[model samples]
Target: MSVLMSAFATLVGGLADLLQPLFHAGSAAAAIILFTACVRLAVHPLSRAAARGQKARTKLAPQIAELRKKHGKDPERMQKALMELHAKENVSPLAGCLPSLAQIPAFFLMYHLFSSREIGGEPNELLGHSLFAAPLGHRWADALTGDGVFTGAGLVYVALFAIVAAVATFSFRMTKRQMAAAPTPAAPEGPDGRPLPGMGAMAKVMPLMSFGTLLTVAVVPLAAGLYMVTSTTWAAVERYFLYREMWAAGAAPKASGAARGAGGAEAA
Candidate 1:
């Protein structure tokens, strides 16, 4: 555990130190966005898994409904049936978690990279040096952009932070709605198949999480914050839409991504 933790720390410190330079121009917000994007881009496997889960879920909805009707009270049989169905279909059962689950590590890495102090005096994993020099601060700064969102930025930034907070509650609803709005190809399913990683209560909490994430980005350098803003908007868009394209690809989706696609990709 210590080694893993140390390695994790290294990954993070390396990211922050490396990318710290990119904050020179635009703002650390920009670098943050870049870092977010780079991380997101690398998480294609999780994205693929999530899309697969989504496809499988849409395909399995009817079966799930039937299972609920037939075995709603028989927990053991329901479990057995569900497992059998999933096994037959080659489903991961938890596959819909691809996008969301993928993001945890990236978030940790971001925190690590964003918060690390001068490790080796080398620019860690970050790409460029600071243009205006927004010296790094606390980890919370990374989470909220180091207090970047002042009241006067715009109704947009103001609204964005609120939206990010409410994203768990509201934005994801729109996302899910959009996802449902777009038709997908059929998939095989288990008898009790529903969307893998159903977004029930989680839906309500996501916007809060989104808000927290954006807030984290807001406190950092303007560049990082700006990147956060752009990436957040982009991510919300992609989360709603990317499934269609990724589903077409087999196990690993290509790296094509929007700003948030790359940035938010890791947050998947």
Candidate 2:
């Protein structure tokens, strides 16, 4: 573990060195952002695969609904049938989670790298780095207590909060749009033909979860907050394009059907 930490420290130091000319005192912070980009780039293929999986699952929703109706009374049978269907279709239901899960290690590394005072038995020099007046190793609370909110470090936090809020808003809207555009699952109706218990509430709450990143950015070390900001922004943009592609793909057949109906009417 110490060896791994040492290597990661070296990587960050190397990136800081490369960025020093441009970023000056904030080079370490810039290096964190660049490291984040590299991490996201490495996981891009998984993200694409996840997108394809999501499209496949969307296409399979109707069949899944049918299975749900057929096996609604038998929980075990339903589970077995769902597994079989996914296997036959070569789709992993959990694929959408890969890109997010893959990033956890990188985030934790940044958090620990900045939080620690020593690395491999030596003083951690990276702690001395700052993004303007904000120390990369410091938290928002530290800045607030030491210099107050209007001071340089506090203003840095303010800027970060603003950016996070904007990104979260973008993500929230995108999520709502996707949910609105998605085909309603022909869920197995309960006695009242309503969605399953808690499902509706969950749907309503999920979109707002995007704003949770604000709380995250506020609490973590500045270095990790930088990573979070970069990553969250990347995710919002990537999701927009991927969801747009999926929407277009899903609409093509409906468009063709409409054209066919119009042609039939003209012939008649």
Candidate 3:
């Protein structure tokens, strides 16, 4: 984790190094949007895979439960059974974990980019000027100390920060809800098909961390901050739609009550 974090920080350092020239062209917003687009595109495949894994789990929920009922205490047997089952169904149990893991690198990259204070040998010109003098659209984070801590704020900066904050927060809540679909299942099976406390356990904690972090965006330069929040919000929107489709696929038979009928309950 530390190595990946540092590598992303290094990415921030590199992007800040080369793209400083675009600041002069008054395209900081464009630059930010472009960078974010590239990052999202890079992670899209993993996101789709995770969605696939999630759908697979939903599709095979009954078999997963039966397997656990039979071998809940034997880790080895559980893993073998899961592998066999997944192979038969062509599903990757860990698929849902991919998108989250992929985002860590991009999240930290944005943090480094936003925390950066200088571009090239020149003082940073986020939207083409000094920190306080830069437009609200440009100053995403306040001017950071050499130690990389944000230092100040203004009315314009605060207002814009709030906008991004709201978008990031709402999108996150909506996406997670869409992914888990119905109330989160308790004791969700893990990748090895072993029964474990379900995602509901973490769901209770993540929202607090998410909202708390979103609230802190007011400390950054406006442009850098918006890039982070906006990209994340866009990713959430994209992910939710993806999950919605996955949900539809998994719950298809249920829509016709076939999933619940006694006549074919065993088949369902």
Highest TM-score: which candidate?
Answer: 2
Ranking by TM-score: 2, 3, 1
Q: lDDT winner among the candidates? A: 2
36-87 per-residue lDDT for model 1 (tens digits):
6776677656766666766775676567667767887776787787787777
Please give, for residues 72-144, the per-residue lDDT of candidate 2 as tens digits: 7787787788888889999987888899999999999999999999999999999999999999999999999
TM, every model: 0.54, 0.87, 0.65
lDDT of 3 by residue, 83-148 (tens): 899999989867777766776666555555445554343444443423334453333343332213
Model 3, total clashes:
12
The Cα RMSD in angstroms, rounded to one decimal, for candidate 3 relative to the true structure is: 7.2
**Worst 10 contiguous positions by lDDT, candidate 1:** 181-190
Evaluate model 3: give its TM-score: 0.65
Please give the distance, in angstroms, between residue 106's alpha carbon in candidate 1 and its true position after superposition: 3.3
lDDT of each: 0.52, 0.87, 0.59
